[model samples]
Target: MSPFKGKTGFKRILNAGGYSLDGLRAAFTGEAAFRQLVLLNVILIPLSFFLNVSRVERALLIAVCLLALIVELLNSAIEAVVDRISLDLHPLSKNAKDMGSAAQFVVLTMIAVVWALILL
Candidate 1:
């Protein structure tokens, strides 16, 4: 068996929660774009509920908004790992970062399209 499978039950859940919180804290502190998106979410997520829309539309709105956050977090992780590997200018590293950025751009566009379709 894998050595990492020791923790189980409530203890595992607590540990997982702690790790997730740590990740969020790290992203909030270190990533400016993450902070901005988080601020946007803070305003938009609740506002979504009040918008005159069907329940499915509301859920889709919220889900896409949250998806932006998820994508941002993953992008930040990619950036962190790439930076950790090297600070020197490297083509592969640049490509990795650029791909992560492109991913964010695509998701942001998706959010816009989803909101416009549902609300407009």
Candidate 2:
């Protein structure tokens, strides 16, 4: 057993927060897709605040934007894990990567559709 696994209580929570920060740093630095999504969020999230939308519309707009970021994070993680397993050309690896890309695409489309419906 590892000593790291035995952590609990506040210490565990603190370590987990640190780990999450590290993951974000890694994603921002290493993944161009993640950075691009982050850039999109930077633009859209604040734009949501400025829009003449109802509270619910604003919230939905922000929610979908955040969802895109979440999906991108998951996608980046999946690609990293797949690459770590093997860089060799494999069908399953390609499928996994493609699926992640597809998920991001869907989220981005959702953001556009939601904003369009609310604004126009």
Number of clashing pairs per prediction, in order: 0, 0
The regions of model 2 sitting more than 4 angstroms off are: 1-4
Candidate 2 local lDDT, 45-110, one digit each (tens): 998889888999999999999998899899999998999999999999999999999999999999
How well is each residue in 22-55 modelled by candidate 1, as lDDT tens digits?
9999999999999999988898899998999999
Off by over 4 Å in 1: 1-5
Colliding residue pairs in candidate 2: none
Candidate 2 colliding pairs, count: 0
Name the TM-score of candidate 1. 0.92
- Per-model C-alpha RMSD: 1.5, 1.4
**What lDDT, from 0 to 1, does candidate 1 have?**
0.93
TM-score of each: 0.92, 0.94
